[model samples]
Target: MDYLELAKTVGILTGISGGLALLMSIAQNTIGNYGEKEITINGEKKLIMDGGDTLLAGLIDNEVFLPSACGGKGTCGYCKCKVLSGGGQLLATETGLVTPEEAAEGIRLSCQLKVKEDIQIEIPQEYLDLKQWETVAYRIDDVTPTIKRVFLRLPEGEEINFKPGQYVQILAPEYQGNDEEVYRAYSIASSPSKKDEIELLIGYIPEGIATTYVHQHLKEGDTLNIIGPFGHFFYQDTDKPMIFVGSGTGIAPNLSILRYMQENDIQRPGIFLSAGRKIEDLPMKEEIDAIAADLPNIKMIWSVTGADPGTWDGPTEWVTDGLKKLVDDAKDSEAYLCGSPVTIEQIVDVLTEKGMTEDEIFYDKFQ
Candidate 1:
């Protein structure tokens, strides 16, 4: 082996790598420096911010919270705003998330848009009222064999107002062995009428950061940080028949919607379909069944993809199959679905094929 030659090659490669990193840093400080910029939102509020940060970050820093389930990772597509001016041009990263109609209206993902200059934009008026609540973990219960329901109580003299079926982002701070502090979105399982506290149904993923913290580290009376009711997936006040398909922890939002429906005496025909791998996989059945019994026109259906023949006698089918077989008013009824991305896509396809238009189908995909 030529030791001297090997050392020379290694030295040359290291030097080149170091030089590239230095050049990148220099470029960031020089070409990428955006200096101070003004962000005018809805033509009512103005904020001065650094140009190098994302529009989402700037807004959040200014106490204007927008929902970003992916936390500004260029995914989730929740943090969208109308960039009325000075947003330059749309980038490839936003093409998949923003539709043509949205693009034509200058809508872009706030996380993907950098504040490069004085920017004028428009956002939902409600976002200005968002608050990061400091609450307590009042109780945690096993909603199912694999899922847990976390009950959070607002601090004294405080309350959270939200539409049933909407979700909130909870912060999972850095704990022992895990250094990442991430915020995760969870659907509110409790009724919105319960203003003092809210409930969330969380399924324990083997190593999921937020779920791990919730199932393992979170405890009663523990202080928890929560953001606002930040999702479009909510019960719409309409007379159209409702078809709700939820799987796994996706049942959380539907539970909220159903409870709200019962509380408000919403009488339009409704069906709640709960799907899982087995009977034990189902969550919140007794409560849902009770809610169903209260609603005059509501029916509850159970579908299991993997049925235990010895102990389970329910229909062995997917929720998508149940959605197709049970829904009769797909052409006019509204469908609200929640679950994994693939499951939501399958349900959407089934509903659309059954004569439902895209606008009639709404979903909150657990991404």
Candidate 2:
């Protein structure tokens, strides 16, 4: 085997391998590609999109953002949509989120459903109008030891029109020790009257990506991205007396609603019940007190579950206990609740037991 002969053989083998690689790439592009497909939404709007991404991602790419607290990880059931056709079989994640009745009615989690072909799905009209906004962190106020109120200012000529109790998804950029960008939903803590500014009452979770960024890395003048006006936990436009229950930063949305009511002079009798582990856990106490003072029809109650009754000035029972004391008949009232899933579940059971119908009790479960 001479050197030239060996060189020629090696070159020939390299050329053959390169040719096969090119062919494989071409095959993948041709075979794996699902190409373009149509997504018919609510039988009114149709979108032409490439058919490969998950339904949630595809909707977002088409400017239709569905509420998913866990992004597209299929953990939060907030992105459930009715798929009349072409959603294929339900996966375990979808089944976990959807009840048997819901599954029978064609409900599926958008995050778990892939758009492999033309599909028809139904989403709320409000979700169709959801928008992603660019804002700057104009202010950060320490509300408590672990909670900070961040004020994001919209750019000129831009505004967010959101219901008082709705929330927005904050996009946390990559920072030290966190290598990827992520989105986390936080309820809008500011009143709807403040169209150009959005406030978020973010509680610091020691190692949480989004909370950590907001607490430690995020600063004034830093640009942030958010998409929202999500969730159906807002106040209904009815004359029924209202009950608002929350804990920790869960009070953010309730505070927004109270402030909005105060701004608009909606004086239906109401009670805002807030619970925390300790005095320090309850943020926005002064603001809540001021709102309650201004609105004669509204009352505020504070409860500390983990504190000793001898030390706490307010109710020492759970928030639900305060709720029971304030409301005599839940059949005539509407309730808006926000908190951890367990807390929301417990309160929902209590409300239902107290004669509040399922439709009258709206809640946002924090994941």
Q: For residues 1-106, what per-residue lDDT tens digits would candidate 2 score against the true structure?
A: 9999999999999999999999999998987479988999999899988887888888877888888788678888988999999989989877777999999999
Q: Return the TM-score for candidate 2, rounded to 2 decimals.
A: 0.86
Best by lDDT: 2
Clashes of 1: 0
RMSD of each: 4.6, 3.5
lDDT, each prediction: 0.87, 0.88
Summed backbone clashes in each candidate are: 0, 0
196 Cα displacement, candidate 1 (Å): 1.3
For candidate 2, the lDDT comes to 0.88
Q: How far is candidate 2 from the true structure (C-alpha RMSD, Å)?
A: 3.5
Q: What TM-score would each prediction reach against the true structure?
A: 0.86, 0.86
Error of model 1, residue 130, in angstroms: 2.0
